[model samples]
Target: MTGGSGGIGGAVARRLAADGTAVVIHYSGGAARAEAVVESVTAAGGTAVALPGDIAEPTEMSELFDAAERRFGGIDVVVNTAGIMRLAPLAEMELDAFDRMHRVNVRGTFVVSQLAARRLPPGGALINFSTSVTRLQQPGYGGYAATKGAVEAMTLILARELRGRDVTVNTVAPGPTATPLFVEGKSEEQIAGIAAAAPLERLGTPEDIAEAVAFLAGPGGRWINGQVLFSNGGIA
Candidate 1:
């Protein structure tokens, strides 16, 4: 799992671990937090390890994958929850910020997905992260949405490309999720308003997104391929 130290990624790790799957948690930073998650999983009698690498860098990511395979013998599922969000209208957004988001979100997903496609055996699944903002069409999300949109497009096509491989490639788009990354710059009023926009009347928890990811990476979602699943509670 990339971005394993982030809110949604961490939740997915724990959730998958709870299902008796050995997990490899990948983090670009926040080594301490990743270790904490690893400890948590082990404490609960689950198998897990923390690995660090830049998901956007193929060589680094390849080494990371090699390490994971060596440790676990093989990889079955790849969940790429690594992404960075910077909110700004297209006119006001800095090119640097846009580039960085693309590097981590779009390029990162591409690198991970490529490795997954080449390495994963039959029945393996690659789950990528996207945001419901692409559908919401909200202001200040142009760049972030663009990055996620690319992810959606790539995942959809990759699934078809792996037609006979028995591998599923899918994207999970979460809406107004209550992760620290989503709440960082928003005020309480802003959050409440966004939450209320959904009929569920609350922001989605990390676990909610994790459930969607777990389903896609698990046996139940084998028939689901080349699809973009909106896991939001009817927000879009």
Candidate 2:
């Protein structure tokens, strides 16, 4: 399940569903946006259902996954793209800000991954979202990066722990992308300036990130495990 409907998670859902995988689109808020994602997939001849839940709560996650299984028989692939990002320097960062990022990015990832690793079929795959800031060490991203860093660490260990289960766990780290979150609070020129920072000289599209996710979840990626595949257009 993914969080916050119309960004990277939505793109991931659409791409996977298009590839013939029925997707369970999870949303923390914005029901209409979530429905739009589901509708997009359905219009393209793919099956998808949008459900809302708090990824940090065990009972809520349980119900979410149960509902998914009921709709699609079983979940063969789990994607924890549910997350929140905020901008603040370490010195000025409030405990609540740090906790908020960790709550969704770290705790949420662990909760979904734990369920997938234990209950999914042998060949199932679990993918999580990290960020390129973990590599570049951008100043304001200290708190956010710490949370994703936690996920990256957990993802690798989880892969080894799932040894014989035939489950592959990995994280995808993306650089600055032209998503709502990236564009928010930025002027057109400022957005252009940030986009130009990447070697490719352009901001990433959600589809770019989704394509990477599709590879990791598909049969072709079964042999790949415990690795963070960076798809940041060489930015990091």
TM-score of each: 0.98, 0.97
lDDT of 2 at 24: 88
The sequence of per-residue lDDT tens digits that candidate 1 reaches over residues 74-121 is: 999999999999889999999999999999999999999999999999
Residue 74 lDDT, candidate 1, scale 0-100: 96
Candidate 1 collision pairs: none
Worst 10 residues of 2 by lDDT: 1-10
Q: List the residue pairs that clash in candidate 2.
A: none
How far is each candidate from the true structure, as Cα RMSD in Å? 0.7, 1.0
Model 2 lDDT at residue 102:
88
Backbone clash numbers for all candidates listed: 0, 0
Residue 129 of model 2, lDDT score = 88
lDDT for residue 29 in candidate 2, whole number 0-100: 78
Cα lDDT, model 1, residue 216: 94
Q: After superposition, how far is residue 181 of candidate 2 from its true place, in Å?
A: 1.1
lDDT of each: 0.94, 0.89
